[model samples]
Target: MHYEKEDWNFELVVAGAGVGGISAALAAARLFRRVLLIEAGPEVGGTGVFSSVSLICNFRDSRGRPITSGIHRELFPAAYTHYNEQRVPTYDELALKSTYQQLLEAEPTLTVWTGCTVESADVENGRIQRLHLQGQQAGTVAAEVFLDATADGNLSAMAGMQYEIGREGDGKLQSATATFRVSGFDLLKLENPDIQTWPAIHSLRLELLPYYQALKDEGKTANPRQSITCFPYPDGKALLFNSTSVLGVDPTRPDSVSRGMEEGTRQANELFGAICGHPAFRQARLDYIAPRLGVREGRRITGEYILTAEDCLNTRHFGDMIAACAYSLDIHSPDGGATRLESIPGDGYYHIPYRSLIPVGCSNLLLASRCISGTHEAHSSYRIMASVSAIGEAAGVAASLAVIQRKKDVREVRPAHIRYVLQLRGQFTEGEVERIPLPASPQQEPPVSVEPNFKSNHD
Candidate 1:
């Protein structure tokens, strides 16, 4: 091994360039912290760009309030404007990647490392002392704070933090999705006009059922719009796919994941080909395939407090709310269909406690992304790209606070002050606690044990 003893330095090193990592890097950079955003792929936006998963999720709070404020408020609304009035632009991976690059390039304090993979890290006293990354120029980087923004919690796993994968009884997390883009056709000419909503295609799928069944019976079959969702884009094109199907994948194993990506792409293409041949998409042609597989579920690190489904249903707001999530529990199945948990009556927003992002026993590392503390069901809601971005912003601020205070444990920060700062920056904050009136119905009583999908071994 070649050893050139050159000390690498950074104030904050953000691992992964998805929404979470981008948010963290931007936040730290704004605070004048020398920041490095490390991405394994050639691009950023994580699954948002890679999987071609469109839509910024929901930005409002439970009470119909705009919860995703701050940078989120800026980015999301601008995205809406880029599209026609009737359509809200699903975040295009390439567009967002350019946006990330442009934003960071303008900031002198931040540097983005694309096509870089973190091989390992040197840890001492519950902190990352040195990080070894391989890319065009293999080198080491040292940072005061490390943000675990990898969708699979790679940093948390490297640091030996507690976490869970898949489900408990079944050990299956959720279905992995493969998104595909199709073009050269007038999607606006479809029998059903509206393209954004899922239900828009429901009737159309039924109308095309006879032809689909005929193909299925002849062994020349293709899944219909019933399994696929199409969102409109500019021109005569659309993103015509959805994340469905659960494959038990071991993320730590490179070979296993590699196989999954190949197979997932094949399935997505098969679906695309079927649609292209069908009457609905006969004129359509394959536009582009996602560079990364859409992984809807993965390893979740056990943090100080696991956000629960009960918390989501109750619309509970914590004193130290890092951000808020308004998306319902959107759980897709291995066979295609999905089940959604209805939002709480009245205002349907929920707050994310800062404690959920702080891993237990780990002093210097914080988690954002799908791996943050939450039950399986709760993670389904919190795992959305929009919410992860918000969480990453909060984690970044907290990490900066740690550096300033010279404190190790994240729990040492004051929740009240954090909220004040976030609010001042235009982030959503819980103003006060309120109790909801329960129905008098006896069956409506709460369950004896209510836990999130991913439960932490810690208290």
Candidate 2:
């Protein structure tokens, strides 16, 4: 019923190694919290690395002022300076992974355990006491506070937390995509050598659609979505194709994901063959398919606040604001039709309340990813990487502050105090705060040795 090393303990434990989990660990460790970061895969980056999601969605207001700052800026430094509102936002996964490794290795208070997952959780009186980890290694870890950064709400669900999945009524989620990469395209074949620009990208897409359509007419492919949507690699040598959709794939169901992967790979290869006829792709070659499926929707953990589509459309501001999102409501069609896009009103952004990250029935647990409480429509907007990073940063700050303040219930920690720390770290915030006496800088925790298998070269 229970399994773990007895002496393992930390001030905070973060699950999953996506951008959200990494941000949470980075934020807390910098504040001198003894933190343990557990990831399921061998690699640190989640979908961003494994799925090769090439684009960086909008994180700035209409005039191009960043609404999601803090760790997000650290990951995508290009967004911090020389941000152009009209340029197509994108990044290379290889570069992002390198940045994550360097930044995480520098945090002395953070301990990373890759190839491990949160197999089970001990929840007592609405608070998490210990988490049982298994996969590459098995052990139990105890913590004063826990943050669930699993994009699928896996940790919360394991803790018996209530959650909603997919659309409100039919339970259909946005289709999953298996992205792929291609390189060695002859750039001289195109009007613009720099296809990374929005205009050049559109032009290239228009040039390749006819060939792809011909393959569809010939029944050579099963991809439902129209047109080829891809972005340039950072080096401008390769293209990351965010195409090949598979409908009704759910991450919580392993069988569904497996079948979806099979179908998605079929689509990826078919589309690749179809596009090879294009002038620009005549010399191109398929690199590889993503290791994991790119799931667009997952379990929305029930929190104190359930953000609504109306809130995003109205661009609502919260008195307990912890993070902000400026990405449009870009919902890919569940049926593989057209994508729906709705821009935020006025200031082109909306605030994410601290209450949304505080899941109900959990005293010392916080959500740090896209799984945070929100309607399917509302979740579609802030589920982008930039906002998720911001959410993780805020959740980390709240968890560490709850520890530092000696609070029995996480809700007892004042949002104003959390905002104070966030503001000091250069995160965007608008909530007014009462000046509370803060503790002196914390000394870094002594490094703890983990199982031999969990150690990385950086560790």
TM-scores vs. true structure, each candidate: 0.85, 0.94
Q: Write the per-residue lDDT of candidate 2 for residues 385-433, one digit (tens) a residue.
A: 9999999999998898788767778787777777777878888887675
Alpha carbon lDDT at 63, candidate 2 = 84
List ranges where model 1 is wrong by over 4 Å: 1-5, 79-89, 187-189, 194-226, 234-236, 243-246, 334-341, 431-459
- How would you encode candidate 1's per-residue C-alpha lDDT over 89-112 as one tens digit per residue? 565667677777777787677888
Over all chains combined, what TM-score does candidate 1 have?
0.85
Report, for every candidate in turn, its global Cα lDDT versus the true structure: 0.69, 0.87
Cα error, residue 446 of model 2, in Å, equals 19
Model 2 off-target regions past 4 Å? 1-7, 435-441, 444-459
Candidate 2 deviation (Cα RMSD)? 6.9
Clashing pairs in 2: 4-140
